[model samples]
Target: MQPATTAVIALHYQNEVLHPDGKIRVGLDSDSPVRQNVLDAASAMFQRARACGLPIVHVRIAFRPDYADLLTNMPIMRGVAASNAMTEGSWGAQFHEQLAPDTGSPREFIVKHTRINAFFGSPLEEVLRIVDAKRLLIAGVATHSVVEGTVRHAADAGYEVLVAAPACASASPVTHQAALDSMSLMAQILDANALAQFFDELPS
Candidate 1:
């Protein structure tokens, strides 16, 4: 894909989600290889995209301390408030260093979302329009949640979606594989290295 028509969306690469010391890491069963060094894979993908002049949009999930902005309709959503996991302005909610955006950069956009699907109630679509991007490369933590959610939405909305499987994972290897299998129907599944090779083939 050409740089001008493609963009990368980095999702939930936050301390509360990706870090070992994250508050939400307690009892999380992410021992799978998919979760290991996952951020490094994503970071390298970002570097390649940047080198190709592809814009990146960083999406985060956070809420007010009072949970005023959060809708607790499920166990996971309730857990966030109960554990104070994704409180806005908290250290846990901050983006992880490996994939954090370079703020003030013209091509990087930071959007805060309150839903599983990044586009729902978020400025993601508007950001894509701003960048004139119709194809997306997505990498995020909890492959079954935010990644699958966003991929499904983007596919249905007529966007060309590619999921970097190596850069994504869920709480379990089983869950992560299942999600990737399901997403393969709607999106192209590529590893970070393959994606880099594809990007390199683009004409200068």
Candidate 2:
């Protein structure tokens, strides 16, 4: 089979200081812990994507707290009343060390911020369009939010979307699974190893 030119997308909850603590106070089902596992899986997936010369994109959540001067009001940003942790320039805003890629130069980072979906308010769609990417491999934190948001928009935009089952985590297991179940009907869902195998079988 021909190698599918793909883009691997990962969402990061670790923003600067103005964003909410995505899962610290949440329950066991919360995404914090699960997000880590998802990230680990994504890292492994990236190895295959890299070998296939596919593009990798990381979505970040960062907000300018000035509600008076907001860009577009998205569902996730409805409560702009106060910022929790993710800001523009804080350690918490940074991507978890494990999920962050080493590009050897700060100038080139996969990180991109958006108000809602990875494609919304961000240059993601444009980038993919430039690369002529037809398939998107997605995994991220807050399956209910970023992951869902991205998938819906991606589908509407007419791109083939795939969700990395083990590469996603949400605030609750129910929410996570629900999102997966729903997306599965519209997109292909695969784990890291399965994804790797797909890429491996692809002809160069």
Candidate 3:
């Protein structure tokens, strides 16, 4: 629970995923309370982590303008291709304004991933290593996708992982809760207040 031993990874907080105007919003419930809760919780967690000096890693999913890195053959990715979602350097690919890192902050790290699992083809692990992170505090859009995928991988990689429940959302509440249930087997699940308490109790 020590701040120094932990890094907060905010995943896919991009305009493409979280904003109402996002390209993928067509496939998501733009008015879902679950989604809003996740956004609010994640924002609060980011603020708390910054105040506590915890390393913050922002993980986003993006691809080349031509989407050469994307698997267009996959059904999910096919939709992405049709919508041109999360194209690198596009407005939709940028992190949501509220959760974006200050460009001048050396402590904030941004990892752009092209895959579902943040670690699959990204510098996430390397950045965590640079911060001496032994545990990861994770939150993001699509609880059933990136959140679940990353939690399983992180657990197998031997990092202590905690999922801030309210900070994760999915297109459906059923899927969201289901993913949370399944991920609990591998990661500790906490709400935002409890996560904040973990930081507050850290030894000074």
Candidate with maximal lDDT: 1
lDDT of candidate 3 over 69-101, digit per residue (tens) = 897666778888898888988999998888888
Give the per-residue lDDT of model 1 (tens digit) for 1-204.
Answer: 233788899989898877777877523644534445687788887888878788899999999989999998988898888988899899999998878898867889899999889999999998898888899999888889899999999999999999988888677778888999999999999975777777888653
Candidate 3 residue 117 C-alpha distance from true site, Å = 0.6
Candidate 2, residues 1-204, lDDT tens digits: the string is 223367778776353311234423223333345545665686777666666666677677664544443454564455433444455565666777666765763212365664657776678876676666798888776677778888988998888988887767765789888988888867888865777677777654
lDDT of each: 0.85, 0.65, 0.83
User: Is 2 or 3 the stronger prediction by TM-score?
Assistant: 3
Q: Candidate 2: which stretches are off by over 4 Å?
A: 1-4, 13-35, 65-75, 78-83, 104-111
Model 3 per-residue lDDT at 204? 31
Q: Which pairs of residues collide in model 1?
A: 143-169
| Number of clashes recorded per candidate | 1, 11, 0
Candidates in order: C-alpha RMSD to true structure = 2.5, 4.3, 2.4
Could you give the candidate ranking by TM-score, starting with the highest? 1, 3, 2
List the candidate 3 regions with Cα displacement exceeding 4 Å.
1-3
